[model samples]
Target: MNLSCGIIGKPFSGKSTLFALMTGEDGGGKFGPVRGMAKVSDSRIDYLSSLYHPKKTTYASVEFIDVPGVSGSETGENKMLEHVRNTESLLAVIGAFEEEDCDASLQGEIQGILDELLLNDLILTENRLEKIKHQRNPQEKDEFVLFSRLHEALEENRPLRSLDLKEDEQKAIKGFQFFTLKPLMFVINIHEEAIPRAEAIENRLREKLANDAHTGVIALSALIEEEIMQLPEEERPAFLEEMGIGEPATEKVIRSIYSLLGLISFFTAGEDEVKAWTIRKGASARSAAGEIHSDIERGFIKAELVHYDDFAATPDMKKLKEAGLVRLEGKEYVVRDGDIINFKFNV
Candidate 1:
């Protein structure tokens, strides 16, 4: 499945500007969504690509949608909320630039975003309760019970993400993808003047939001990112060094999103192609095979696997095999972060 993230913030909040920088394309204006694909960079993939020197090299990617800038009007806010509900994660941009600093209190703006999200989920819960109450089946697969509990939690101003739902309960309500259940990241978009204080602000937000699971806080100058976009590729590194920024904020944001989502990549290397595939951290071999192709998964043979570090160190397939670094595993074997697997299967 293709995972998606929603970019959301108030109008004139540097939301679109950041999206443009991150994507190198025009994210839609104040009223529409722009879809962009961002490649997930992995050094392991790069190393394997060089080793194989394959005709095709693929990287795992996450799709991001720049939702229309939310405004004070109910229509715009509803549209933004609709987009947010459809994503696996939410990137909330807070405008700290002097030009857009109508709200002086950064923390208050953050709270307002949280409140809006909670209220949106609360509305969804209430609507679901009303529908469930009138359901034709009294024993409707326990969904009514599940949603009732969710409604209670939403009423308490708690996001559904914090709930520790068990396996069975999770299955029961699997179809209802709740907004509050998605991970969230806060992007503090500051001006160049605030660049030096950016880390300090991020640290403060980190301390304040430390207890929240699947949440991250980051600070960046969207203006600097815009300038980076307009500069020549060779000059960008030196400019970043002078600006006291180690890497682009988009990179940092993506890294945080990966950690928040508990996603990891494994590889398949060959003379024809070297590809990177993403899966949940604890995913099994069978699931990884399914990521490649369903027929391979259906055939259900053992996997020939090697750890990336082992392969990188040896640098030769023949030597690695002779050293017994390549191992065989059944479908149930849990995949690691840097596994390079060849699925041995038949039609």
Candidate 2:
């Protein structure tokens, strides 16, 4: 599955800068949306590659669509809405670098962006309901009921994501791709001087969004991250250490997106390839096999699974099997993050 996210923010919020830092693409001057893929950095993948000595190593990635910075004009709003409607999630960048009262400013900016999204979704919901009212199909009745509940929530300034929707209900309105229903993460773009206080700023935002499960917060200096990305790969760690940053902004953002979207990774390793696969949390073994190849899932038999940590400790298939650490799981087995799986199947 393609895990796509839309990057959005008010102009001069460093939205494009963050996008460039994450994807290594400088498309700041573009009038249309810029598309790029950011690889998810995983230590587990690195270890598997080393152990398997694979000729090819692959990391899971997130496709980012950086739309033109949103402005107050209706044209800009409409353009942005058109570009991001199909994305699975959103990353809202808020400027906090130059504000004297960072907390207040951040809160205001967040609320303003959210209000706009709520209004956009409200309009769509209202229009759809109006159309449904004129339709006589039996299916329209069910759609009208579901949309009515959505409209009630949107009308009250509540995000549709806050609603506990069932699987079929989600599918019914999936095509609409309501803005407020997608997972969202707020990226607080701080200044170099604010690095020491990054934790506090993130904590404040987290507190504000404590009740919103679909939303998350992270603080990073886009300027610093851009600088870090420009350096040689071998020189990055020293620079990060000097800057007192624990992890690169790109990695943090990628991981944050995964967590916000309820995603996990499982691995398939061998001499030819060591690759990471992304799947929704609680996905079954058969479902994960399908992510690799439909034939593997179709001829499903068992998943020879071993946790990464267990393999890392033994680092020997013979020893692992002797210890009963490698076991076969059925199609219904729930795949876990960092699970090294070898699907046993015949096509």
Candidate 3:
């Protein structure tokens, strides 16, 4: 839920523009990374707020850091790599607009970026394996064997992300945090005219886009998004309606990120507050409670649970009780999206 993603791309790409559109802010005129906290839009939160009339309502948010473009300089690449390593995921922004030359095709751009990532991992792995090989110690020999296998994969242009390492093996090389191992989500900043072909483009790249279980592809026009942002708040909805756009660039990015990271939201509503909480898709009730506070998790007894659908039908607590829709769930219960939960705890 606290996951932060890094926005990365080559120079001349719409990385900064996409960052501005996603964060609902101007890309600051500075040298370093621009950080923003973006709301995870949810209709369920609005429904809960209307029903409960909470004094204060909150939506879940995710952090995004816009890393400066990386290109020729090794120092620049190193700086960018540092930021990339700090993030839980990466969003690669590729400029896919049709130019007179049309040199930067979407497929070619993605392939180039991926090649750079692989090269970065390859260099690091080779260096570490060389050190391990030079050591005669039996413990070092075991590490040499594992890293050598990794070296073979890198040599074949296979990224570390494709590897399905065992739990113990995962523990072994986790510290390396190889560049190619991070989950990736791509944005093809296509021309406004190409909007209709977005689905086709995604379908065409589906095989390549399936870089791993946590990878996805999105085609968007930052040009359109920028224009939309310039419109008055009252006029924007109608504009989007006329354009046949269900979601804005920011919303699409947020949804893609949540899906890529396997995040789900749960709600807690009352007169005091209606809040949306984020958790991993398969997070247990106890673990979700810990997200709220350590004390609640420590003293956990049971969770008062009901799907938001049931609560929506019988919004009143009295009605929900009458229908026996609300149930008590133990800590082992896996929280689902749109679940309404109240922790029963004494501390």
Candidate 4:
């Protein structure tokens, strides 16, 4: 499945600017969602593109949507609650920038936003628990038990991820789609001078959120990303290196998101199309086939594969075949990262 992240923050908090940088578009405007795809910016794509020089070199992409900021309310003019509900992951941009000696109290704002999310979850959990209680003979009492635990957790200002629910218990609560339960990437928008101080901020957030699973906090200057995006593509790397930045914030955040989501990439290369496809780690060949096409999955067959590292070393598919680097796997074979595949099937 394609990964997606919803960008949200306070009004005038550079949320749209970050979205523009991520999607390479001018998405700055007043009142609507600007949505588009962003390349995952994997080095493997760059290496492959350099080698093949295809008419259209495509990298795997994730969808990014800029939703209006949360207003710290369940009912508001902005549909941020709806956006948060629909997103698989979140990128909460907290503004901490200033020119004057004004106190940028992000902790309070973040606490308020978090409180809203927790309240949303608590309300939903309570409603569901009430429903389960109404049933005299429940189909699955485990759901009630798990949800009760979750309710208690939320009551203590903890998210569902903090609980150890069974797989079935987790599935049972999936339909609720609590906002606080989703994977979160907190982006702290620091001042330009404090760009070097990001590590400290990350450490602080980490200390406070030690128990949350798959949570990441990154410090970045949105102004820096905005400036870098405006520069010519060739000049970006040198500018970033001079500024003591390794990569664009978009790349850094997206890479972290991919890791947190447990997504991996496998390739299908040819003169026709050299493409990257996202799949879950340990996904079977048949399941991956369904990502490309449902028909290909239904008509299961063997897959010709070559490990990407081995292929790069040989620099020739025919040579790899000759060297026995090529292998064929049945439907149950687990797909690995950088595996070049060709599915043979009869539908």
Candidate 5:
């Protein structure tokens, strides 16, 4: 899956810097929007690549879009909000660095952005509710009831995702794209020294927003990430060890995203193409085939599969077959993480 995440934050929250670090894209300076794809960097792919030494390997990637900084001075436009809606997920970078005298307007600016989201959601909810109310037919009364329940929840400062909407109620609101209803991961960008306090902030957020399921918070040091990104790959571990940084911000961010978004990865390995594919945790064999190609999904017959570790140890498909580690799964079978699948599709 091409899972795209957009970075949004107030001015100087390091959204652009984080974007550059994640994407390895040079936008000249940290001003305008910057977008690029970064490899998912699966070790299984590396192992398979080494085993096969194929002509090529394809790494799964996440697209990152960095919007220009927003501050109290700037006008809160719908453009940025619209940009966020285009993505599969959102990463809101909140400034959490230490300062002698913190600017009072920072929180207000952040709230302004959030207010925009609320307003956007509010308008959508109102419009949908109005449409249901105006439907003259009594046969659609049950449908209108769904919208009414959702409308009440949205008006009461509750996101549609947060409310325990029935399956049919969820289907009712599907046409109204509510901004606040989407899953959001908040990245608190802090200074280098603040890295140690990252977990503490997450704890605090969890305590404060105990009921909010659609949102999660994580603290990251963007400046530190930028520094780490500039270092040679071989030297990174030593540098991180010296600084007591466990992992790069990029890895933490991606892992956090995977967890928050309920995403899973299944691998396809060979020298020709060793790749990791993203899917929702319970996605089926046919759905995974569709991610690779629509034709494959249309013709999907079965999936020839094995664990990455099994392939790594044996280094031969025939050996895996003999060992009984390789198995064939039908279209209804759910894709499992680390599963190395060779889709058997006629198309």
Candidate 6:
């Protein structure tokens, strides 16, 4: 899947800096929106790459679009919203290190962005509801009911994601692409000096969003990420160790995005290629096969599967088979994260 996420925030929220660090693209001097892909660093892929010594190794990635900072003006906000409406998810960067009323200010900033999303959705919902009121078609009737429920939720300051809609219901309004329905993560940008207290800061910020569904909060210092990015590749690990940073913030952000979006990866390993394929959570074996090619999904019979952890422990295919760790799964089987799958197909 080609997943894309938009980086959005108020002016001076360090969103551009975070974008640069995430994508390794310095959009500082650019105008409008900047786009780049960030590879999701997976240890399983790394291990498989080493084990297979593939001629080509590919990691699953997410595209990040650094939208120009949102402004107070309606036109500016609308333009920013337009840039992000089609994105699968959003990362709202909030500058948390310099505010005098830090906690309160952070809360306000989060609410401000959320209000913008809610209001925009409300307007769309109301307009659609009004237009369909005079119609009598069955499809329009279903939409009227859906839009009416959405309008009520938006009016009550609720996000569309909070509703427990069925699969068909979700498909019905998928085209509307309501901002409030997308996965959102709040990236609290802090100063390098606050690195030691990053956990505390994240916890506090998370409390503010405790009630929001389909939302997540994480804290990172963009300055530190910038420094890490500037370092030579071979020396980056040492730099991170010296700074007492367990994992790079960019990795954490990518992992969080996957979790928030309910995505997982399954792998196909061989001498020719070792690759990670992205798929939605709870996707069936046939659906995962389609990720590689439609023909594979069409003629799929079964999946030869082994969990990555089991393979890592044994490292030898024969040994894994001997231990009964490798199994055959049917087309209806749900693919799990880190599963190594070889589809049995004929087309």
* Runs with alpha carbons beyond 4 Å of true place in candidate 6: 28-31, 73-75, 99-101
What do the candidate models score in CA lDDT, each in turn?
0.83, 0.89, 0.82, 0.79, 0.74, 0.89
Question: lDDT by residue for model 6 over 84-154, one digit each (tens)?
Answer: 89999999998877637377787888899899889999999999999999999999998999899999999
Tens-digit lDDT track for model 1 on 19-95?
77766678865556888887776778888887779999998887888987766555668766786566889899988
Per-residue CA lDDT of model 2 for 70-91, tens digit only, reads 6765466767768888999999
Consecutive 10-residue window with the lowest summed lDDT within model 6: 22-31
Steric clashes per prediction: 0, 0, 0, 0, 1, 0
TM-scores for every candidate against the unseen true structure: 0.92, 0.97, 0.90, 0.89, 0.86, 0.96
- Superposed Cα deviation of residue 232, candidate 6 (Å): 2.0
Can you tell me which runs of candidate 1 are displaced by over 4 Å?
99-104, 134-138
Task: Name model 5 segments beyond 4 Å from true.
Answer: 26-33, 72-74, 99-116, 137-143, 164-172
Residue pairs that clash (backbone atoms under 3 angstroms), model 3: none
Residue 39 Cα positional deviation in candidate 5, in Å, after optimal superposition: 2.4
How accurate locally is residue 305 in candidate 4, as Cα lDDT from 0 to 100? 95
Ranking of models by TM-score: 2, 6, 1, 3, 4, 5
Worst 10 residues of 4 by lDDT: 99-108
Name the weakest run of 10 consecutive residues (lDDT summed) in model 3: 99-108
Q: Of 2 and 4, which scores higher on lDDT? A: 2
Candidate 1, residue 199: Cα displacement in angstroms equals: 2.4
Model 4 Cα lDDT, one tens digit per residue, 1-347: 76787787877777777788778776544566668788887777677777777666678777888876644543562366666577678778887877442223655656666777788889888988898876666564767777788889999998776777777776777887778878888888878998776787788777766777767888888898889988999999999998888788878987887777778999887666678899999999999998899999999799999988998888887899899999999999999999989998879
- Writing each residue's lDDT as its tens digit, candidate 5 over 1-347 gives 66878778777777777777777785323445667887676777788788778788887777887777666466654666566676767787877677531334334444455566777787876776677676778756777776677667767877666877677666666665566766777777777876776777667665544676767777788888778887999999998888778888677787676666778788876657667788888999999999889999999999999987777778788888998999999999998888899999896
Candidate 3 lDDT for residue 241:
84
